[model samples]
Target: MREAEEFVDITLLFGEGHVKCHKVIFMILAGRSDYFHRMFLTSMVESALNEVPIEEISASTGVLLVDYLYTGRIKLTTRNAQDLLVASEMLLLGALKQNIEEFLCEQIESSNCISLLNFARM
Candidate 1:
């Protein structure tokens, strides 16, 4: 779906980057995320816009989120996991946020535990 980019109805803009995706994907994600439900299902301004500006997360992270919604898979790395977590929180995706938190916890070591704690606090 990402490769084909067919029947895509929404373009999420993030800073200088953007992600093109289908509204059906958002409709499915609406069941799992209240934020998506409100933004795409209700009579909100975003529901009527073809291009929605997303200031919360980077376009890279947005791609991951959309891919996860489409494929139910994501390759979470230490570099991108933090941003994904923040994005999931903002999107009200509890399961995704928990998955990221668990992944981060599994990666914690004495060397990085304090830093991880501080990051979590933020």
Candidate 2:
């Protein structure tokens, strides 16, 4: 493996915010998401600059996304699951999306079923 500084080649800009990560982390994302694969491999500007701008996602959610990308773990709860779902969908993270969906499904019950349905539709 390359040294940390040498491996760190990409800057992900998220809604006027940004994060730095190793190219290896991005390789993991590319393997997982078609969106990221295309972004890194096919998008001329991003491929050349090694930078990606994610304007629609919040920095906190972006952090979560990166954490999941690197660590393969995410903290999902009722408070943040919805936003994470949106982020995962936007990022084309199929595994994370399915995880969130399954979590939400498990949370469904008599009281929150309708609310969960509405949220899912949105």
Best by TM-score: 1
- Candidate 1: regions farther than 4 A off: none
> Residue 6 lDDT in model 2?
61
In candidate 2, stretches whose alpha carbon ends up further than 4 angstroms from where it belongs are 1-7
Worst 10 residues of 1 by lDDT: 1-10
Model 1 TM: 0.92
Model 2 residue 13 lDDT score: 86
Model 1 clash count equals: 0
TM-score for candidate 2: 0.83
Q: What TM-score do all the candidates reach, one by one?
A: 0.92, 0.83
lDDT of each: 0.87, 0.83
RMSD of each: 1.2, 2.8
